[model samples]
Target: MKTLTAGRLLPVLGTLLAALLCALGPGAGSASAHAALTSTDPASGSVVPAAPRQVKLTFSEGVLLSADSVRVLDPQGRRVDESKPAHADGKSNTAVVGLAGGIADGTYTVAWQAVSADSHPVAGAFTFSIGAPSKTVAEVTTAEAGPVVDALYTTGRYAAYAGYLLLVGGCVFAGVCRSSRPVQRIAVGGWITLFAATSALLLLRGPYAGGKGLGSAFDLTLLGDVLATKPGAALLSRLLLLSAAAVFLAVLFGSYAREDGDRTRMERRDVAYGLAIGGTVVAVGLAATWAMAEHASAGLQSWLAMPVDVLHLLGVAVWLGGLAALLAALWSGEPVRRAEVQRFSRLAFASVCVLVATGLYQSWRQVGSWGALTGTEYGRWLLLKVALVAGMVVLASFSRRWTGRLTDGRPAPKKQAPAVRAVQAATGAAKAARPSRKDKDASPERAAQLARQREALEKAAGRRQRDADEGRSGLRRAVLAEAGVAVVLLAVTTLLTGTQPGRAETEQRQSAASGGARTTAPAASGPAETRIPYDTGGTNGRGTALIRIDPARSGNNSIDVSVTDPAGKAVDVPELEVSFTEKQKNIGPLRTALKRTSAGRWQATGFQLPMAGTWQLTLTVRTSDIDQITEIRNVKIN
Candidate 1:
């Protein structure tokens, strides 16, 4: 029985030990994640001759612009912009600010914090020189950013760690607890901890991602808005999936455990429960990864990018949790059926493999190039995580070999005792006749006794080997330790994802460019020459007025006029009037003399100008003798 037990456990122990070392290694550090800033306006640092009338910013995705979306400050740090920032031309992704009049010649810094349509907060500041400006004023105070948001962010991470620990611990307890009652207690605690952690994450999402908090928790309007945004939609979908998983777990706990079932039935129940719990945890992990990617707005169809991320997170949870359970089984030594340990070991091995594969793919996608791995903070952290995972694989391999050797049953070597001498006269006479010194030293009785001792030594060696195998339970301890390290790595990952990666570098590049200035020469141009003529077909208020405009260049020109009420039964007091720029002016109280020529036409020659550029036109229409309507049209000259 001892031999069989030792054979069964060696493999499991070896695998766990390897995993622990991997978790503690630098690879764990490299696996952190976060969003990156792609671009900004004012080109980071720039110089302009005059104060611009407005400031505009464009982002990688659509953004929601409101009163606090952006702020402009003078060199002395005084607020300059008066009106709240608004979406430029109703574009959701662009923010525009109207500048106040007092903006003088000086260096001005534009500090902006925009909430992406996906609910992620992105902030940046740029210095733009206004006529060799120097003083700076509009600084972003940390308090205005809100304390609740920061606290929520920190708490959410801590809760994730706690939840992970409880989950692993519960799995361990379930594997090894002698009493069903203790197993139930551990399971319940695990679920409760997981629930609390997930809830914390949900609450923190709003504030950390630039939302208003609990008031918006159940706001259907906010939900609708979130759905409209890609990041928000993805997160909401993941949460719903997680909720479904939670429901499945509840049902399994409430109904499945109560059944007295055969092995097959029990196995089915176990699978169902595992799926439910695993799915929920996986969904939560995917959502976290999405938040880290910063491309939350990519929509649900971004499966090509998201699947690896989801798999990476889910695989980590399964591998870590399984290791904990397996370790606990080994530690208890009793009550842990060997078959159960073997089953769990197989599952854990598969999970570790999956984790490694998905992690590699995700790392490739995020880091982009080997240079980024060494040059960027995100890349460095990812490298650390990869190293840890590699170490875990090596450990798992060693354990697998140990388990195989133990499980392969082999009998202990046989022992034989020397035959006892026959007490015959012939044998005594033979021994007396050969009584030399050598014969005395190598007596038959003594040789026979030594043979018996050799057989005993072999039996003792077998017993000791069996005991050593049973006592060396390092694998289980190593697995549990690895899981704890994984928790810390995950926390660091969360923090890295929260920070902006290339903001400082971008700012520096902008500053260097602004230091140098250049000037360009204006081109010379020609002069303007014009000619005009007027004619009348009749003398009465009903008469036709003709005017022509002939430019020296013989190109397109325009004419305009203002006319008063004409006293005529046919004309109806000149109710409607139209005019073009650079044409006839106010001609009379009753009529205006503007017309096209034979060389041009008989109509208002300059009225319908054919050219490219802005062409201003004014129109007046009288509703009644006392009431009138007037409008100006700055038509596009092109």
Candidate 2:
């Protein structure tokens, strides 16, 4: 966009990016999910009276779950959940799995692993029981993603973001802001990068979500599955938009270069309107893809959030991208038009305003509360982003102040060109040949030679100075520094998109806060239940033993133990015994004999818990007269 004489093309692309930013919020699952489990059907620690038909899990944002992503295991190591995997609905957050035909009454652990929208593998588990909240076999927590997958996925996103800025920035800034070939070339490069990255993301989507290596990235089934998702559709839309923008840019930029020939050519207004305005409209339309796919579409007041995000993205493109284009022109040592600098200044200021206003809203929505700001990973990244933006503004102000020198209607000083210096040398030689008033001491011929030598030396000194200084243009350097900061800011934004949202973290924190309180209350009055699984060595002896304590108090309590195999069948044993030992007090192992209530079930009339402590319970099973085995389990006797 080298049409330097007129407001050749309007700066409409800025509006597009600014709007995109405003419409898109950053976090967990393409900003909506951050991969946190939003809700569970029975709730994390809720005690359901009877087994539900299915176990339902809701993510904060949409996620990709594999076939084995969910599981329900009983105390006997028997899988009580169906094997058929369930995928989350498109643009939806929930997933469900059917419970097996019959689940014995005891604690059941539901362990799950799913891929978030950001393409990171995450896992977690929750426990619920049929009758009493049986003691859990093990409290399985959240699983972390592999580092290689994280790094590769992040690299792909970074490339995509860079491409976005380049394509939009080049088209808008080079066409309207500064109008330069350097900027156009940069934009074209951006277009190519965008295409490549989009393709990479498609391939990587499978491996990313499946938690597999790069080898599995090209899985056709996985790719098809991802394509059916909200984020997938958004990415595909971006590719289409990029293709359209490329065509528009090629025709628009090529026509101006070929037809105009010079800045004063004054391209017909109709031609400019058809090419430039239409192209910008297409670019702006493309921003909707990002807005629809990200956090803006899912969080609070999404209707308003999407529009605001669009404006924000537009502002960033115009301000940051325009600045980069301006830096290119300045580096060429071209006489930068004062008016254009002023136009950019005003635009930058407006962009900052939009960014500040929209950023505050997004932060509030995603962050939830003040405590989460310091407590959550998402909050910390947001703070860093703000700090970076603030620093960028300060640098931008400096760039604006530097541009003021150009506005003073003075050209930047430069050493004489070769032609002018040659003319000066000839003139000096003519004067030196005659006896000038200033230099009358030497002979005329000697003075002529001295003058020639002096002129050569002057030229040599200027060249040396230019070389030593590395031909640096201070005006260019200052603006370029601001552009560099913009790159860093984009990097932080990319990372932020992969992190958990503060709102979700805040909810998790609240859940944790209330968990202990629930545990202390009686099961008769509350859903506080614990189910622990234990295994003895031999096949016949290896079975789960269930224990339920009502008001599991500090005095006498009725206890029952049911032994079952992996197939969910009750197994009979010759003898069954139960005992408890407290480590803290180093107390005696109070033992008791249990009378068989059924083939594999035993019951005791009275068992005493003298105090509250973490107790180890051992169950001894006698498969035959001699072959006996025992399993130990830890129980929180609060």
- Candidate 2 structure quality by residue, lDDT tens digits, 500-556: 676755554343333324544332332123444555555565666676543343333
Q: What's the distance in Å from true for residue 98, model 1? A: 2.5
lDDT value for candidate 2?
A: 0.63
Residue 88 displacement in candidate 2 (angstroms): 11
Highest-lDDT candidate = 2
Residue-level lDDT tens digits of model 1 in 1-638: 11123354456445444543343233221111121123334433456777788888765446655466678877566788888988778866578888898578876666666565434565544456676645443443311225466666566655554455445434433433222444444445555665665565554455455446555555665455544545555545545655564564455455544554655866866776675467566545534645434532232223554665555555555556545545544544323444555565666655666665555444444444444456544555665665555455545555554444343222223311111122123334444454466645897997666656555554444333333333224444445555556666666566544432322222222322222111121211221211221112223322222222222111122232223224312222234454544222111111222432232223222122212223344554444445555555543322
Q: lDDT of each prediction vs. the true structure?
A: 0.46, 0.63
Deviation from native of the Cα of residue 325 in model 1, angstroms:
2.7
Best by TM-score: 2
- Taking all chains together, the TM-score of candidate 2 against the true structure is 0.65
For candidate 1, the 10 contiguous residues with the lowest summed lDDT are 515-524
